[model samples]
Target: MSKVRTCPACADGAAAGDSFCEGCGRTLPSDIRDASVENPDSVPTAPQVSLSGATPGPEHDGRPGLVPEDGPPTAPQVSLSGARTSGPDTLATQPMRRDSVPSASGGPSPSTETARSGGRTATSAPTVPAWPPPATGSVPVKPTNPDLCSWCPGRVRTGFCESCGRLQPRGRDHVEVCAPGAVGVSDRGLRHRRNEDALGVRVLPADAPHAPGAVVAVVCDGVSSSPRSDEASRVTAEAGVTVLAERVRRGEDPRRATGAAMTEAARAVAAIADSPGSAPACTFVSAVVRPDTGAVTVGWVGDSRAYWLSGGPSASASALLTRDDSWSEAMVQMGMLSREEAMRSANAHALVAWMGADSGQIDAHVSTVTPTGPGAVVLCTDGLWNYYPEAVDLAAAVPGAGAAPREAARRYVDLALGAGGKDNITVVVIPVPGGGGPRAGQA
Candidate 1:
């Protein structure tokens, strides 16, 4: 009913009415709403030239002669840095203001924290309060046994591919992070060669005075089209989570902290590529639990999401807290397209917003939730969510909200891989610590 407003390759953070890529001037993909399931948004009117001098073929899906899948494993990888091709202004070259203002909550003043990344020295200040801290004496992550050979499912013993006969350059391409109450896993999955998705988690010391033991989880999916997107996604996730978590540590307002972090993340990602037109980008989503008040905060760009799996001892209840900034998600929310119809459309998965220099001036979409019972907050990239779009379905497939955070994260990754690992998979699970929770087998 309306002009297509999302970009499949850019899939997570494009603004609602943007007509072209902010990083690149390429025309954005359009959303077509009809029983045909094709994307008119992706249909190009101009002909592209072939190397052999043949007439440019008609475009299909997101782009002609490109993989039909708009996001990674298909073509999402290419647009991670800039949309489509060598368009004129692929990135913003001007300097970005520091998103991290000095903590006003009786912590450091603005003069100390302003834009430290561009090479400024800050006078050391007393440690501000951080939401609960990492668990005391938690064992160092196991160097062996936790990760299987990414190719053959064999234990990556000895840090070599000896048992599986597969050459694993990065040793299973998996990363696991843990804190006092949360654990997250990032995997390359079965399909993609490189794991472009990245995860970050930070927990307060169990004895933290402010929001003791609270945890923050951040997940980002690299735009595959850009060069060295893996690096970009990793940087974005780390920078975003670090800024927010540190802000909380300093007792900053959670909502404002989230906004500041998104700005920090965008700047960090934009700086990843110095060469003009090759800046890398990624989608971002985060979950934070404030145990003292039983509240959960979620912030996101693009489609990466956060879900509250709360309920029983029954543990069957769940709800999606983040609204995807994707084409079809917007259409359904706006009542412009039916849910079933939008999900089935070829352009349904295109991003409406994301993180990167190319994403251009984005405000992180944020929301809060108070669970009725004890549970966990699950934050993940599209690689896992695309397989289980509905919260109920995701809750059903994952371990009950009461399960240990590490196990829960591992289970979700297993579920996605089993359901057909189409892309890189990343999941972070943060358990709600104070309320009554479900028993082990409740779900």
Candidate 2:
């Protein structure tokens, strides 16, 4: 009769030729088990590797206080014939070493067996080590707004849908700002993932300086290639408006205040960069419309633009206020390329100047225009101009007299979105006094 084989730890029976105990998944010793004989103190077993990538002593059970006080436990001397073990614990509790990994052939390879039989041990360095069991505890759940994501039942966290793995719409994805004398709209165009454009508009109080009813507006377009460009544009718009309002309140010249606002905006954008390589960048355009004197001062960097649309029917004339700091414009100005040729070049839209830490010393182009008749001051990013491409086309699209500034601004944004919205769009509309629109403070 074949002798019965059994696991020493669990006292479970093992069939003939079986290497592991089925009861607890423990390594089975090759030696026979019989009540007539006492079990051996030490049995040859597979080498074990610790979490620290080191070979542990024979008595190392990973539990503290097991080591003798005198010195480290001595390793046992035994012959490796059939049995192999990963550690003192059964396979259910202990992670297997990489070298003794289970194979299609049903057991360790011949080479491994040879090494073991020769009293040699080996260890494997797996690319990823086993991790400890997760701590057991109750976790607090945070309350969430279920309606944040439309496509998935999962909650939206940090602008992303956790279940569907989709990007969630942000607050700035579409924004509208309405003030007493100006209205602005910004949107994440159809083709972009988020809105990188920002707008700020404010109408000076009735008791303020030279231009009491002056409207201050700033539009910034984040450079798509820069990291956190959206943040750069937002901070720039905010800082520009704050400084412009402060300077204008102090009775500063419209042109000088616009320039100072640009300078302050540049500093704010520059401070957003955490390092030289990741400097957030953007294009800036600001307009200050003084309805009292019919004076409009525009300042700009990069390709964002400002335009003055003369009041009247759709056929009314319009003028481009700020010059673009773009490669095409620079080429045309230097006579290096004709207007049509420059526009056709691949670098046509490349910015020659922008607001960022890397962009040194910004000299904002400032211009003042005093229109005799009523008109509207429009400030926007290229997203809107790329569709119209001309002052007259944009002027024709503006709502006629008596249209609320907010309505006009929304109309312009809708026009851009209807045109495929290949990029982020932003537009600020400030009706010049006598422009025939609703008076100041009208929503």
Candidate 2 collision pairs: 46-85
**Candidate-wise lDDT, in order:** 0.55, 0.57
Over 67-101, each residue of candidate 1 has an lDDT whose tens digit, in order, gives 11112110111123333331113212221211110
Whole-structure CA lDDT of model 2: 0.57
Give the TM-score of each candidate.
Answer: 0.62, 0.61
| lDDT, candidate 2, 175-276, per-residue tens | 666576777777666555556788777677766645676778889888754556677788898898879877986799876787788878888888888765
Error of 2 at 24 (Å): 48
* True-structure RMSD for candidate 2: 33.2
